[model samples]
Target: MAEHAEAEHEEEAEPRPKRAPIDWRRGREQAFSILASIVRWVGLIFAALLVLHVIFVIGSANSANGIVSFVRGWADGLSLGFKDLFTPSDAKLRVLVNYGIAAIFWLIVSGILARIIRRIGGVVSS
Candidate 1:
Protein backbone atom coordinates (compact mmCIF):
# COMPACT_ATOMS: atom_id res chain seq x y z
CA MET A 1 0.00 0.00 0.00
CA ALA A 2 1.07 3.67 -0.34
CA GLU A 3 1.04 4.03 3.49
CA HIS A 4 3.66 1.29 3.78
CA ALA A 5 5.91 3.04 1.24
CA GLU A 6 5.41 6.38 3.01
CA ALA A 7 6.33 4.87 6.38
CA GLU A 8 9.49 3.42 4.89
CA HIS A 9 10.40 6.75 3.34
CA GLU A 10 9.88 8.57 6.63
CA GLU A 11 12.00 6.07 8.47
CA GLU A 12 14.83 6.32 5.97
CA ALA A 13 14.63 10.12 5.84
CA GLU A 14 14.93 10.60 9.60
CA PRO A 15 18.58 11.44 10.40
CA ARG A 16 20.41 9.50 13.07
CA PRO A 17 20.67 11.26 16.38
CA LYS A 18 24.06 12.74 17.23
CA ARG A 19 25.74 11.83 20.48
CA ALA A 20 26.09 14.74 22.86
CA PRO A 21 29.54 16.06 23.68
CA ILE A 22 30.94 14.57 26.86
CA ASP A 23 30.85 17.20 29.55
CA TRP A 24 34.51 17.57 30.54
CA ARG A 25 33.14 17.86 34.04
CA ARG A 26 32.10 14.24 33.64
CA GLY A 27 35.74 13.21 33.46
CA ARG A 28 36.38 15.08 36.69
CA GLU A 29 33.28 13.48 38.11
CA GLN A 30 34.59 10.06 37.16
CA ALA A 31 37.88 10.82 38.92
CA PHE A 32 36.01 11.78 42.05
CA SER A 33 33.79 8.71 41.75
CA ILE A 34 36.87 6.54 41.42
CA LEU A 35 38.30 8.09 44.55
CA ALA A 36 35.01 7.59 46.35
CA SER A 37 34.92 3.98 45.14
CA ILE A 38 38.39 3.42 46.50
CA VAL A 39 37.42 4.83 49.86
CA ARG A 40 34.13 2.95 50.14
CA TRP A 41 35.74 -0.25 48.94
CA VAL A 42 38.18 -0.11 51.81
CA GLY A 43 36.12 1.37 54.66
CA LEU A 44 32.85 -0.53 54.95
CA ILE A 45 33.02 -4.13 53.81
CA PHE A 46 36.51 -5.48 54.26
CA ALA A 47 35.78 -5.30 58.01
CA ALA A 48 39.13 -6.85 58.65
CA LEU A 49 40.80 -3.54 59.45
CA LEU A 50 39.50 -3.56 63.01
CA VAL A 51 41.16 -6.92 63.37
CA LEU A 52 44.36 -5.66 61.73
CA HIS A 53 44.52 -2.66 64.04
CA VAL A 54 44.06 -4.90 67.02
CA ILE A 55 46.61 -7.39 65.79
CA PHE A 56 49.08 -4.70 64.88
CA VAL A 57 48.73 -3.29 68.35
CA ILE A 58 49.14 -6.62 70.10
CA GLY A 59 51.75 -8.12 67.82
CA SER A 60 53.84 -5.03 67.96
CA ALA A 61 53.17 -4.71 71.69
CA ASN A 62 56.87 -4.48 72.34
CA SER A 63 57.63 -2.69 69.14
CA ALA A 64 53.91 -1.94 69.52
CA ASN A 65 54.10 1.79 68.96
CA GLY A 66 57.29 1.46 67.02
CA ILE A 67 55.79 1.64 63.52
CA VAL A 68 53.44 4.53 64.15
CA SER A 69 55.85 6.28 66.44
CA PHE A 70 58.56 5.90 63.89
CA VAL A 71 56.37 7.67 61.36
CA ARG A 72 57.44 10.97 62.83
CA GLY A 73 61.02 9.80 63.12
CA TRP A 74 60.86 8.55 59.57
CA ALA A 75 59.87 12.01 58.40
CA ASP A 76 62.76 13.60 60.23
CA GLY A 77 65.19 10.94 59.10
CA LEU A 78 63.95 10.56 55.49
CA SER A 79 66.72 12.42 53.71
CA LEU A 80 69.35 10.88 55.93
CA GLY A 81 67.86 7.35 55.95
CA PHE A 82 67.56 6.46 52.27
CA LYS A 83 64.70 8.94 51.79
CA ASP A 84 62.32 6.19 50.71
CA LEU A 85 64.43 6.08 47.57
CA PHE A 86 62.88 2.86 46.31
CA THR A 87 64.68 0.79 48.92
CA PRO A 88 63.46 -2.81 48.83
CA SER A 89 62.12 -2.63 52.39
CA ASP A 90 60.36 0.69 51.83
CA ALA A 91 58.91 -0.29 48.47
CA LYS A 92 57.59 -3.64 49.62
CA LEU A 93 56.54 -3.13 53.24
CA ARG A 94 55.53 0.54 53.39
CA VAL A 95 53.88 0.74 50.00
CA LEU A 96 52.13 -2.58 50.51
CA VAL A 97 50.89 -1.51 53.96
CA ASN A 98 49.60 1.83 52.64
CA TYR A 99 47.77 0.20 49.73
CA GLY A 100 46.39 -2.60 51.93
CA ILE A 101 45.02 -0.13 54.44
CA ALA A 102 43.41 1.97 51.72
CA ALA A 103 41.78 -1.06 50.08
CA ILE A 104 40.40 -2.45 53.33
CA PHE A 105 39.14 0.92 54.46
CA TRP A 106 37.20 1.46 51.22
CA LEU A 107 35.75 -2.06 51.30
CA ILE A 108 34.42 -1.53 54.80
CA VAL A 109 33.00 1.90 53.93
CA SER A 110 30.53 0.40 51.41
CA GLY A 111 28.48 -0.93 54.33
CA ILE A 112 27.98 2.59 55.64
CA LEU A 113 26.33 3.57 52.35
CA ALA A 114 24.10 0.51 52.49
CA ARG A 115 23.03 1.34 56.04
CA ILE A 116 22.32 4.95 55.07
CA ILE A 117 20.20 3.95 52.07
CA ARG A 118 18.28 1.41 54.12
CA ARG A 119 17.51 3.99 56.78
CA ILE A 120 16.38 6.49 54.15
CA GLY A 121 14.24 3.89 52.41
CA GLY A 122 12.61 2.95 55.70
CA VAL A 123 11.85 6.59 56.36
CA VAL A 124 10.45 7.12 52.86
CA SER A 125 8.31 3.99 52.97
CA SER A 126 6.94 4.86 56.37
Candidate 2:
Protein backbone atom coordinates (compact mmCIF):
# COMPACT_ATOMS: atom_id res chain seq x y z
CA MET A 1 0.00 0.00 0.00
CA ALA A 2 2.90 2.41 0.74
CA GLU A 3 4.47 1.75 -2.68
CA HIS A 4 1.19 2.42 -4.44
CA ALA A 5 0.74 5.63 -2.46
CA GLU A 6 4.31 6.71 -3.36
CA ALA A 7 3.67 6.09 -7.04
CA GLU A 8 0.47 8.10 -6.88
CA HIS A 9 2.27 10.99 -5.17
CA GLU A 10 5.00 10.94 -7.82
CA GLU A 11 2.44 11.05 -10.57
CA GLU A 12 0.71 14.00 -8.96
CA ALA A 13 4.00 15.91 -8.56
CA GLU A 14 4.87 15.63 -12.26
CA PRO A 15 3.64 18.57 -14.33
CA ARG A 16 1.33 17.98 -17.32
CA PRO A 17 2.47 18.97 -20.81
CA LYS A 18 1.96 22.63 -21.65
CA ARG A 19 -0.75 23.72 -24.04
CA ALA A 20 0.22 24.70 -27.58
CA PRO A 21 1.19 28.37 -27.54
CA ILE A 22 -0.80 30.75 -29.72
CA ASP A 23 2.14 32.73 -31.07
CA TRP A 24 0.68 33.01 -34.58
CA ARG A 25 -2.69 34.21 -33.30
CA ARG A 26 -1.03 36.93 -31.27
CA GLY A 27 0.91 38.13 -34.29
CA ARG A 28 -2.22 38.11 -36.45
CA GLU A 29 -4.19 40.03 -33.83
CA GLN A 30 -1.57 42.75 -33.65
CA ALA A 31 -1.41 43.05 -37.42
CA PHE A 32 -5.19 43.25 -37.69
CA SER A 33 -5.32 45.97 -35.03
CA ILE A 34 -2.86 48.09 -36.97
CA LEU A 35 -4.76 47.56 -40.20
CA ALA A 36 -8.06 48.50 -38.56
CA SER A 37 -6.59 51.75 -37.24
CA ILE A 38 -5.30 52.70 -40.66
CA VAL A 39 -8.64 51.93 -42.28
CA ARG A 40 -10.46 54.04 -39.69
CA TRP A 41 -8.18 57.02 -40.30
CA VAL A 42 -8.67 56.79 -44.03
CA GLY A 43 -12.42 56.65 -43.56
CA LEU A 44 -12.31 59.72 -41.33
CA ILE A 45 -10.31 61.63 -43.91
CA PHE A 46 -12.79 60.78 -46.63
CA ALA A 47 -15.71 61.82 -44.46
CA ALA A 48 -14.02 65.09 -43.56
CA LEU A 49 -13.36 65.88 -47.17
CA LEU A 50 -16.99 65.22 -48.05
CA VAL A 51 -18.26 67.36 -45.17
CA LEU A 52 -15.95 70.21 -46.11
CA HIS A 53 -17.17 69.98 -49.66
CA VAL A 54 -20.78 70.17 -48.53
CA ILE A 55 -20.02 73.18 -46.34
CA PHE A 56 -18.24 74.89 -49.22
CA VAL A 57 -21.09 74.25 -51.58
CA ILE A 58 -23.91 75.20 -49.21
CA GLY A 59 -22.20 78.30 -47.80
CA SER A 60 -20.92 79.30 -51.22
CA ALA A 61 -17.37 79.37 -49.97
CA ASN A 62 -15.22 81.62 -52.13
CA SER A 63 -13.18 79.56 -54.57
CA ALA A 64 -10.64 82.41 -54.71
CA ASN A 65 -9.62 81.62 -51.09
CA GLY A 66 -6.74 79.18 -50.82
CA ILE A 67 -8.35 76.99 -48.14
CA VAL A 68 -11.63 76.79 -50.00
CA SER A 69 -9.93 75.86 -53.23
CA PHE A 70 -7.82 73.23 -51.51
CA VAL A 71 -10.84 71.62 -49.85
CA ARG A 72 -12.74 71.55 -53.10
CA GLY A 73 -9.83 70.02 -54.96
CA TRP A 74 -9.33 67.31 -52.36
CA ALA A 75 -13.02 66.52 -52.23
CA ASP A 76 -13.25 66.35 -55.97
CA GLY A 77 -10.28 64.07 -56.26
CA LEU A 78 -11.42 61.70 -53.55
CA SER A 79 -14.96 61.46 -54.92
CA LEU A 80 -13.99 61.22 -58.54
CA GLY A 81 -15.93 58.06 -59.38
CA PHE A 82 -19.10 59.08 -57.56
CA LYS A 83 -19.20 62.61 -58.92
CA ASP A 84 -21.94 63.84 -61.28
CA LEU A 85 -23.86 60.59 -61.07
CA PHE A 86 -27.02 62.57 -60.52
CA THR A 87 -27.88 65.81 -62.22
CA PRO A 88 -28.16 68.51 -59.51
CA SER A 89 -30.80 70.92 -60.76
CA ASP A 90 -30.15 73.41 -57.91
CA ALA A 91 -27.61 74.36 -55.24
CA LYS A 92 -29.09 72.27 -52.44
CA LEU A 93 -29.40 69.28 -54.72
CA ARG A 94 -25.85 69.73 -55.81
CA VAL A 95 -24.61 69.51 -52.22
CA LEU A 96 -26.63 66.35 -51.67
CA VAL A 97 -25.29 64.66 -54.76
CA ASN A 98 -21.67 65.77 -54.55
CA TYR A 99 -21.09 65.32 -50.81
CA GLY A 100 -23.80 63.00 -49.51
CA ILE A 101 -23.01 60.18 -51.92
CA ALA A 102 -19.28 60.32 -51.18
CA ALA A 103 -19.85 60.30 -47.43
CA ILE A 104 -22.22 57.37 -47.65
CA PHE A 105 -19.90 55.49 -49.97
CA TRP A 106 -16.90 55.87 -47.68
CA LEU A 107 -18.94 54.86 -44.63
CA ILE A 108 -20.25 51.72 -46.30
CA VAL A 109 -16.87 50.67 -47.70
CA SER A 110 -15.16 51.28 -44.39
CA GLY A 111 -17.75 49.30 -42.52
CA ILE A 112 -17.43 46.39 -44.92
CA LEU A 113 -13.66 46.38 -44.67
CA ALA A 114 -13.81 46.44 -40.88
CA ARG A 115 -16.21 43.54 -40.83
CA ILE A 116 -14.05 41.52 -43.18
CA ILE A 117 -10.96 42.20 -41.12
CA ARG A 118 -12.68 41.15 -37.92
CA ARG A 119 -13.91 37.95 -39.51
CA ILE A 120 -10.44 37.12 -40.78
CA GLY A 121 -8.93 37.75 -37.37
CA GLY A 122 -11.48 35.57 -35.69
CA VAL A 123 -10.88 32.76 -38.14
CA VAL A 124 -7.13 32.97 -37.68
CA SER A 125 -7.37 32.99 -33.91
CA SER A 126 -9.76 30.07 -33.85
Candidate 3:
Protein backbone atom coordinates (compact mmCIF):
# COMPACT_ATOMS: atom_id res chain seq x y z
CA MET A 1 0.00 0.00 0.00
CA ALA A 2 2.85 2.39 0.79
CA GLU A 3 4.44 1.57 -2.66
CA HIS A 4 1.10 2.18 -4.40
CA ALA A 5 0.77 5.60 -2.64
CA GLU A 6 4.35 6.54 -3.62
CA ALA A 7 3.69 5.54 -7.27
CA GLU A 8 0.58 7.74 -7.41
CA HIS A 9 2.47 10.69 -5.98
CA GLU A 10 5.32 10.21 -8.48
CA GLU A 11 2.95 10.06 -11.44
CA GLU A 12 1.10 13.19 -10.33
CA ALA A 13 4.41 15.07 -9.93
CA GLU A 14 5.68 13.92 -13.33
CA PRO A 15 2.65 15.03 -15.37
CA ARG A 16 3.27 18.78 -15.30
CA PRO A 17 1.21 21.04 -17.56
CA LYS A 18 3.02 22.14 -20.73
CA ARG A 19 2.47 25.76 -21.65
CA ALA A 20 2.64 27.15 -25.20
CA PRO A 21 5.24 29.86 -25.76
CA ILE A 22 3.87 33.37 -26.15
CA ASP A 23 4.54 35.16 -29.43
CA TRP A 24 5.13 38.77 -28.40
CA ARG A 25 5.79 40.10 -31.91
CA ARG A 26 2.42 39.15 -33.38
CA GLY A 27 0.60 40.40 -30.27
CA ARG A 28 2.33 43.77 -30.44
CA GLU A 29 1.60 44.17 -34.16
CA GLN A 30 -2.14 43.57 -33.71
CA ALA A 31 -2.35 46.06 -30.82
CA PHE A 32 -0.47 48.70 -32.79
CA SER A 33 -2.65 48.32 -35.88
CA ILE A 34 -5.95 48.62 -33.98
CA LEU A 35 -4.94 51.84 -32.23
CA ALA A 36 -3.49 53.32 -35.40
CA SER A 37 -6.72 52.78 -37.34
CA ILE A 38 -8.87 54.34 -34.59
CA VAL A 39 -6.59 57.36 -34.26
CA ARG A 40 -6.43 57.90 -38.01
CA TRP A 41 -10.17 57.80 -38.54
CA VAL A 42 -10.95 60.01 -35.54
CA GLY A 43 -8.34 62.59 -36.47
CA LEU A 44 -9.45 62.72 -40.10
CA ILE A 45 -13.09 63.26 -39.24
CA PHE A 46 -12.33 65.91 -36.62
CA ALA A 47 -10.02 67.78 -38.97
CA ALA A 48 -12.55 67.74 -41.78
CA LEU A 49 -15.26 69.17 -39.56
CA LEU A 50 -12.97 71.87 -38.23
CA VAL A 51 -11.99 72.89 -41.71
CA LEU A 52 -15.63 73.08 -42.79
CA HIS A 53 -16.45 75.19 -39.75
CA VAL A 54 -13.65 77.60 -40.54
CA ILE A 55 -14.78 77.92 -44.13
CA PHE A 56 -18.36 78.57 -43.11
CA VAL A 57 -17.30 81.23 -40.63
CA ILE A 58 -15.17 82.98 -43.23
CA GLY A 59 -17.82 82.89 -45.96
CA SER A 60 -20.25 85.09 -44.07
CA ALA A 61 -20.52 86.89 -40.78
CA ASN A 62 -24.16 85.77 -40.46
CA SER A 63 -22.94 82.16 -40.12
CA ALA A 64 -21.38 83.14 -36.76
CA ASN A 65 -24.83 83.46 -35.20
CA GLY A 66 -25.72 79.98 -36.37
CA ILE A 67 -22.70 78.56 -34.53
CA VAL A 68 -23.76 80.35 -31.34
CA SER A 69 -27.28 78.93 -31.60
CA PHE A 70 -25.96 75.43 -32.15
CA VAL A 71 -23.90 75.58 -28.93
CA ARG A 72 -26.77 77.03 -26.83
CA GLY A 73 -28.85 73.91 -27.59
CA TRP A 74 -26.59 70.87 -27.82
CA ALA A 75 -23.73 72.10 -25.63
CA ASP A 76 -26.11 73.43 -23.00
CA GLY A 77 -27.23 69.96 -21.90
CA LEU A 78 -24.25 69.62 -19.55
CA SER A 79 -25.40 72.56 -17.41
CA LEU A 80 -28.86 71.12 -16.69
CA GLY A 81 -27.76 69.95 -13.25
CA PHE A 82 -26.06 73.23 -12.40
CA LYS A 83 -27.46 76.68 -11.62
CA ASP A 84 -28.29 79.26 -14.28
CA LEU A 85 -24.98 80.19 -15.87
CA PHE A 86 -26.70 83.31 -17.17
CA THR A 87 -29.27 85.25 -15.32
CA PRO A 88 -30.23 88.77 -16.43
CA SER A 89 -27.31 87.90 -14.66
CA ASP A 90 -23.57 87.39 -15.21
CA ALA A 91 -22.92 86.94 -18.93
CA LYS A 92 -19.29 86.00 -18.32
CA LEU A 93 -20.15 83.32 -15.74
CA ARG A 94 -22.68 81.84 -18.10
CA VAL A 95 -20.18 81.52 -20.91
CA LEU A 96 -17.54 80.05 -18.61
CA VAL A 97 -19.95 77.61 -17.05
CA ASN A 98 -21.16 76.41 -20.43
CA TYR A 99 -17.63 75.85 -21.68
CA GLY A 100 -16.57 74.10 -18.46
CA ILE A 101 -19.42 71.63 -18.60
CA ALA A 102 -18.83 70.89 -22.25
CA ALA A 103 -15.16 70.26 -21.63
CA ILE A 104 -15.84 67.83 -18.77
CA PHE A 105 -18.37 65.87 -20.78
CA TRP A 106 -16.04 65.68 -23.77
CA LEU A 107 -13.18 64.41 -21.61
CA ILE A 108 -15.32 61.68 -20.10
CA VAL A 109 -16.51 60.50 -23.49
CA SER A 110 -13.03 60.54 -24.98
CA GLY A 111 -11.62 58.49 -22.10
CA ILE A 112 -14.28 55.81 -22.38
CA LEU A 113 -13.83 55.53 -26.14
CA ALA A 114 -10.08 55.20 -25.76
CA ARG A 115 -10.42 52.39 -23.21
CA ILE A 116 -12.82 50.56 -25.50
CA ILE A 117 -10.42 50.82 -28.42
CA ARG A 118 -7.55 49.53 -26.28
CA ARG A 119 -9.56 46.54 -25.15
CA ILE A 120 -10.49 45.76 -28.72
CA GLY A 121 -6.83 45.94 -29.59
CA GLY A 122 -6.03 43.35 -26.93
CA VAL A 123 -8.74 41.04 -28.19
CA VAL A 124 -7.59 41.25 -31.76
CA SER A 125 -4.01 40.60 -30.69
CA SER A 126 -4.98 37.45 -28.82
lDDT of each: 0.50, 0.82, 0.54
At residue 121, candidate 2 shows an lDDT of 80
Model 2 scores what on Cα lDDT?
0.82
Pick the winner on TM-score between candidates 1 and 3.
3
- Per-residue lDDT of 13-85 in model 2, one digit per residue for the tens? 9999999877888888878877876787798789888888888888887889999998888888878677787
Report the Cα lDDT for residue 53, model 2. Answer: 82
- Candidate 3, overall lDDT? 0.54
Shift of residue 7 alpha carbon in model 1, Å: 34
**Candidate 3: regions farther than 4 A off:** 1-64, 77-89
Q: Model 2 — TM-score against the truth?
A: 0.74
lDDT of 1 by residue, 1-126 (tens): 999999999999999999999866556555555655565655543434433433444445444366555543333232232334343553335543443444454454575664554555445444
Q: Candidate 2, clashing residue pairs?
A: none
Is candidate 2 or 3 superior in TM-score?
A: 2
Error of 3 at 55 (Å): 18
Q: Deviation in angstroms for 27 in model 1?
A: 32
